[model samples]
Target chain A: MAQEERRILVAVDEGEESLHALSWCLENLVLQNSKDTLILLYVKPPRVVYSTFDGTGYLFSSDITAAMERYGQEVADVVLEKAKKLCNNIEKVINMVENGDPRDVICEMVQKLGADVLVMGSHGYGLIKRAFLGSVSNHCAQNAKCPVLIVKKPKPANGNQ
Target chain B: MAQEERRILVAVDEGEESLHALSWCLENLVLQNSKDTLILLYVKPPRVVYSTFDGTGYLFSSDITAAMERYGQEVADVVLEKAKKLCNNIEKVINMVENGDPRDVICEMVQKLGADVLVMGSHGYGLIKRAFLGSVSNHCAQNAKCPVLIVKKPKPANGNQ
Candidate 1:
C-alpha cells in the first residue's frame, strides 16, 4: 500500500530532548504509516548585536560569527549521529545550520523548504532556566505556516523509549 | 469524600471563541471528580496614547475610567451566564477586568491570585484576539507563575471527552 509522503522539519538544539523529539516524530510517522523526509535544522544567533556608527551601516563581522555557526553545526552533528539509527528509506534525513534567531528561522526555513510539519521538543534548556515552554518551539507553534507537533519532555527515562 | 479543589482562570473576552473556550474548560472539569472555581479575567489596554501635554502619570484615575470599568462588569455577566450550567459544588465564580497590556495584566493576575491552572481556547477576536493563543496566553505561558492549559483551536472534537 502506498503511504502518504510527509515532510517533517525538526529544530534540533542537538540535546537529549531533541533526540527524543526526533524519536517521537519517527514513531508518530510509523503509527500513521507515513513516509517522511526529516530535516534536522539548527540555528546560531550572533554572539553580539551590531549597530551602525555612521552611514557605513552596521559594523558586523562574520569571522567569529562563522565560528559560532560551526559550533551550532557541531551540535547538529551530535543530533545527526543519533538520528542515524532511524535514517532509512522510509525516512530521508538532512541537516541544516543557519545563523539567526531560532524561532524566526524555524518558521522561515520550513516555509522556504516546503516542509509539511514541524516537530519540536517542548521543554529544553530554555525552560530549565526560565521555567516555561522552550521559546523556540513556542514561537514556531504560534507562527509556523504548517502544523506543529510539540513533544513534551519525556518523563524521567524509564529505561524505555 | 473531601476532594482537592481545582481553580481555573479563564481569560474572558467578548469573542465567539472565548465563549467556546469557557465551555470546553467547564466540560473538562466536569469529567474530573472534583469541584472548581472559575475566575474570568479581562484586561483592558490603555485607551489613549499618552502625550507630554496630556499631563498625567502612566497610571490614571480609576474614577475617570469608571465608565470603562463598568464595561468590564458587563463582560462578567456574559461569563456568569455561560457558567450557569457548569456550576455544581463548583463554588463561586468571579470576574476581574483590569486595564493594562493584556499580557502583563494576565500574568500579574495569575501571580496575584492563587490559581491551579489557566485554560484558554485557541482563538480570539476584537482588538484583543485569541488568535495564535492571543498575546496574553502566549506571554503568560512564558512568564506567568502558574501552569497553563490551552485548548487548541479547531482541535479534533472527534467525540473526545
Candidate 2:
C-alpha cells in the first residue's frame, strides 16, 4: 500500500524543552517522503496584566498591548528560525502563531488541521509545580483526537542524537 | 562519534494504547544501530481491595492476594510478549515489572535505570475522565528527569504509521 501523507503538529514555546522536541521531530518524525509536513505551532498567551494610569483602576492601554503583541511576534520568529536551521528540508515546515490559551489553542488547531500526531516537549516541571500550573501538553494528550508524542531532551551526559 | 548506546524505556500495560506505543518505538525510535536498547516497563497498581477488606469486617484472604499477583504477572507477560514481537531486534529489549502506583513507579524506574528517553502511550481518556481517574503518562512527563514521549495511535482515516 502507498504511504499516506502524515501531518505532525509540534507545539513550540520559548523554552528549551520545546526546541528539543522540535529538533527531535526534525530528526525522527519528519519522513523523507515528499508529502510529509511539519507544522510548528506557537500559541501566544493572552495578556495577563493591564497598565493602570493616573490612579485609574484596571484600565488597559493600547500601547502596552501593542508592545506585548510585538514581543510575541519576536518570540515566534526566533523559535521558528531556530527550528528552520535544524531541519534538512525547511520547505516542508509550516509556521503558525495564534493568540489564546495554549492548552485550548493546541487542541483546536490539531483538530482543525486533521493532525496525525501532536508532538510536545515535557516542560520538566515537578509534580507539585505541574499540579499548580497545569501542563498544556498533558491537556492536549487527554483531549486531542490524534496521538500525542511528548519528547524530552536527553540529559547532558547522554549527548544529543 | 559512533552512536552512543541509547536506552529507550517504554511503559507497557494491558491496553491497545501501550502496544501502539511499543510499535511506534520500534518503527521510529529504534534505529538500525545495534547499540540501541529498548526497555519495557510494566507497573502494576498496588492492591486497593486488600486495604479495603482489612478495614471492613471481611478478613483478607491469602488466596485473593495470590490470585491478584498471578493476574498481574499474566498481564505483564502478555504485554511484553506483544512488544517483543513488534521489535526487529529482540536481543536489545529488556522487560521489567514492578508493583506500585503506576505514576510513581514509572517515574522512579525511568530515573533508576538512567534511561535516555521514556516512551509512553496516552490512554486516550478524556479530560473529565482523567481528572477523576488520573493519568500516569501525564504524571511521568511532569516529574521524570529524562525526556518523556507519549505516542498516540493515528486515526483510522490517516492509517497506521
Candidate 3:
C-alpha cells in the first residue's frame, strides 16, 4: 500500500505558548514534503451559560448567545490566520473550529480525524495553581487517543520569571 | 554557524506507557539523519527516609540504604538497556540517571542539558486522581524550559478502559 500523509493536529489559542508550539512544530515536526498535513484546531467553549436577562428583566439570552458565538468564531479566525502565516508550506495547512470545552474537543477531534499526533502548548501554571485551576493540556494528554506534544515557551536566560 | 544537533530527552520507567512513548518516538520523531541525538533519562527519587532497625534492635539504616541505592541503579540500567535496544541508531543515544523528585529532576535536566525537547508518557490519571497524586509529566510541562511532549497510549477500540 502507498504510504498515507501524516496528519498533525495542533491546538492553538491566543496564548503565546500556543504560538510557540506552532513554531516549534514547523521547525521540528513538519517535514518539507508533500506527505504531511498540518491541521490547526481552535476549540471555543460553548457559550450556552452566558445567557442572562436584559435591563427590563426580560430574557435577552438568544441575542447575547448569538453575539458570543460570533466573537468566538472571530477569535478562531485570527489565531488560525497567525498560525498559517508562520508556516513555511501553507499548502499543507487545514483549519478546524469547534464549540465545546477544549479538553474534550481536542481529544474528540484527534480520534475523529484519525490524526497521527496532537500538539498543544502548556499554559505554564505552577503546581499549586494547576492543581486548583485544572489544566486543559494536561487533561488532554491523559485522555487523547494519539500522542500529545505540550510545548512550553523557553524561559529567559536571566533567570527572571 | 552550522546548526547544532537537536537534543531530545525522553523520560522512561517500568510502566508500559513510558515504553510506548519510546516506541512512538523512534517511529515518529527520530529521522534517519545525523542531526538528532536522543537522551534516555530515568529519575529515581532520593531514598532519604529508609530508617530501619535490624536484629538485636540495632539500626541498620546505612546497610539498607546502600542496598536500596544499588537496586535503584540496577533498575535504571535495565530500563536504559531496553530503551537502547529499541533504537536503530544506538550510537546517538545517551543515558542519564539522576536521584531526585521526578518532576523536579526532569525539568532541571532539560534546562541544564539545553535539550530541544522533552518527551514523556502520560500515566492516564484522571483529573480528580491526578489532582491529588500530582503527575510528573504535567508538572514538567508547566515548568520545563523547552517543549514537552506527553505521549498517551492509544485507547482500546472497543471504548473500554
Which structure among the candidates has the greatest TM-score? Answer: 3
lDDT (Cα, tens digit) per residue for candidate 3, span A44-105 = 76553333213355565676768877877887899888988887564688888887767788
Per-residue lDDT of model 2, residues B7-123, tens digit only = 888888777778888776775556664587788888767777334435666655888788877876887788778877777564688888888777888889888998877888886
Instruction: Report fnat, model 1.
Output: 0.00
What stretches of model 2 exceed 4 Å from their correct place?
A1-4, A31-35, A48-57, A88-91, A124-133, A152-161, B1-4, B32-34, B49-57, B88-91, B124-133, B153-161
lDDT of 3 at B67: 93
- Lowest summed lDDT over 10 consecutive residues: which window, candidate 2 chain B? B124-133
Best by lDDT: 3
lDDT of 3 by residue, B101-123 (tens): 67788889998998988888886
Tens-digit lDDT string for candidate 2 (A1-161):
11457788888877777788877666555655547788888876666521321336555578867976787689778877776676656457788988776778889999999887788877622233234347777788778877677777667776763
All candidates' TM-scores? 0.46, 0.78, 0.81
User: For candidate 3 chain B, which ten residues in a row score worst on lDDT?
Assistant: B124-133
Per-residue error for A5 in candidate 1, Å, reads 2.2
